[model samples]
Target: MSVEPLIELKGICKNFGEKMILNDIELNIYPGEALVIIGPSGAGKSTLLRIIAGLLAPDTGEIYIKGQNRQGLIEDKQDPIGISMVFQQSALFDSLTVAENVGFCLYQHSKLPERKIRQLVEEKLEMVGLPGISHQYPAELSGGMRKRVSFARAIMSNPDDSRYNPEVILYDEPTAGLDPIASTVIEDLVRRLQQAAQVCGTYVMVSHQESTIRRTADRVVFLYEGQIQWEGKVQDIDITDNLLVRQFFSASIDGPIRVIN
Candidate 1:
């Protein structure tokens, strides 16, 4: 691991009306590692992922990327390094074609020609195993296909500026609704994308699926009751005696975690 973290969160807290989501959260994302967060629904994993992506601001906390403290949301100021996120919903625009959606950033910001942008968009789509559907609309694709399109968009790059290449990726329930085989494909894609990242093969994922957590995670953190109750390496999760880990993995009705109706 590097001497410094690529991303760091200190005392992160968030709330929605009367309920508090994340509480006093702290984490560090090191280079060349796949970190996964696992917990039941309403555990605040997705919220923390957005905060790290700079898409959402915490009620109280600090976020640092590449050692520079982030001020306000991503629209307020750009981070020192590139950070991208694949949202849980696949969040694609109904009107735009897959190519348009994937190259949205470059189209809006870069000086690249339209032809070049299309080529780059196709390249990214192929990287995610979604080739030759750039002209199709999001509504025309299947759920897994749309998610792959979103993945393509998240990994899109600005050829004019190498600094814009993504260093860290935040994934929110990437395999949520997919079939087992499809979910496995998505997991493989995540690992492949990490190897293709510009600066480091680093990614942070939020998942509840046992296969995903075990296959993709180099390290795992267990979140519950608005905090990380346990953390360890991927294999450690099986052997660790942490009550949270034990209960979560076992799918037990009895433990510190009580299921919500």
Candidate 2:
């Protein structure tokens, strides 16, 4: 792991009108690591992901990318380095074919020719294990296929050759709404993508799924009540005695975490 942080969140605080979503979040995302943020629903996990992706600006905080201040700068627009986001919903254009969706960024941003773009798209599709379906539209594909297509689109560029390939990929609920089998497939793909040499990058994911948290995280952060309650390594989760952590992992409602009716 690199000593220098790939992404940093310093004093991140977000408020939606009157409700506080995130409170004084301080974090360091290292290079080539899978950092998973786990939290209950409406805990602002996705909001935090958006902030890191530079989609949403925090009310008060400093976002540093490779040690450069990125305040008020939307990362997607005029970002110095590559950062990609896989949204909770597979936000694909239904009209566009799988190939078009995967290659959209390349065609719009790069000077690469159509043939080269197509080739890159095919390569990415194959990387996600969904080759030969490029000609098909998103409507015809399963939910899992659409999600993988979104991933391919996010990582289609080459990180070493060009600055366009994402150095960091933010996943917002990657395995949401999928059956156990399909969820396992998505989890396997995420693990494979991070380990693959061709497109390995730092990944930060927000999920409520316990299996996803265990399978994909190199480190885990538990966000609740708009703050980080506890955080530790993936293995430590099983041994920790923290009330919130134990209750969360075991799905025990008779502990410190109470549901108000």
Candidate 3:
């Protein structure tokens, strides 16, 4: 049986002054799937993500969460219905230690005890392959470590509390600015998270990294010029004859895509 979409977007549109960022976009993200949105720097990939995260309001369109109309609801204010974001910049608090940062959401939103929160934090860190650094501050951690910490933070939740567990985790360039090995670690962690029964949820990631797209995506959506230019299963990307897909994967300069210099 086909699973119902966890999140759905319809007639989505956005404008920044005179320039359009997204245009009548439609998408369905299914449960237990990793959907990756990809495009170049100016392709509005991030804008699409922010709109889905409810960080920015769209000029027009509707968002459905679990088949419920949510266009009128505001994020954070409405409690986002089990949605979380792992930012491209890591977005960690320098003043807070790893443990504190990881548990920040739980402390703010839930009535969980401190000791239990700390235990959950440690488990999340360990899951992301970064154990025993909970006491260290974010500033002390390397770039890769900090990214992993953000991943841990995104996945941390009370085992007994379903409200604290995100049903959709949106990753904005989770592997950006990391070395190959570090990138691989993040990729593996993403795959693991999607399959893990304890934390499995529908995930949507926006990234430009070729390796990241190849390694982490179960489905791929290629957004360009304010629309979804192409989409298919991850394996279809390599063999698909779509010019944009071919040029993007091959990194060829001779295609129809023109680079601004």
Candidate 4:
């Protein structure tokens, strides 16, 4: 039996003034699937994620989440879905301690007591393999630790208990500046989060590291020249002979994907 897509984008088109970013893009994210988007810079990878998160509205296209048509302005001012994003830079507040940072969303969105919020924050931090570091500030932590904290914060739930599980998690260049070891840790965390959530909630991430993609992605979508040029499972990547894919995987400068002068 075919599973219903958790998220679907049909003929999605977006542009900034005259420059087109996403062109007739169509994608479907099945529940519990991890879809990694790979592309050269400016190929609209992050833009697509933002669009899916409803942070940006496409010029033309349709976005459906959990079989509901999500087009036009959102009726609810809050985020349409239980979606969270982990930015590459681990955008944590310097003033807030790690626990406070993780619980910030809960405090703002729900009426939960401070003690309960702290407990949930600790749980999320432990889930990310960083327990008892919640008392420290972001500046006091290492880069990898900061990223893990951000991951924990992104998954933190509100006290009102609306929905503890996120419908989707968007990761933007998750391992960009981290070392190899740190990158691997982040990759493992992504997989663990998917398993723990146990929901059909989709995971869509943009990354440059082949190892990270292979480790975390169930499917890969390659974007080039402002569109998705190739897509397949991670295992098929080596066998597929698409020029763009070959060039990308090889990290070769000589390929169809050219840098503008």
For model 2, give the RMSD to the true fold: 1.8
Q: Taking the tens digit of each residue's C-alpha lDDT, what string does model 3 give over 2-23?
A: 8888888999999999999999
Per-residue error (Å), model 4, residue 156:
1.4
- lDDT (C-alpha) at residue 146 in model 3: 91
Candidate No. with top TM-score: 1
Residue 93 of model 2: what lDDT? Answer: 93
Best candidate (score: lDDT):
1
Listed per model in order, the count of residue pairs whose N, CA or C atoms clash below 3 Å is 0, 0, 0, 1
Residue-by-residue lDDT tens digits, candidate 4, 1-261 = 899887889999999999999999999988788999998888999999888887889999898887788866443444435778888889999999998899888877787788898899999999999988989999999999999998898887663565544778889988888999999999999888888843324689999888899999999999876788999999989999899889888888898889665
Pairs that clash in candidate 2: none
> Where does the lowest 10-residue lDDT sum fall in candidate 2?
71-80
Question: In model 2, what lDDT does residue 111 have?
Answer: 79
State the lDDT at 211 in candidate 2. 91
Q: What is the lDDT of candidate 1?
A: 0.89
Off by over 4 Å in 2: 75-77, 158-161
Please estimate how well model 2 matches the true structure, expressed as its whole-model Cα lDDT: 0.88
RMSD of each: 1.5, 1.8, 1.6, 1.9
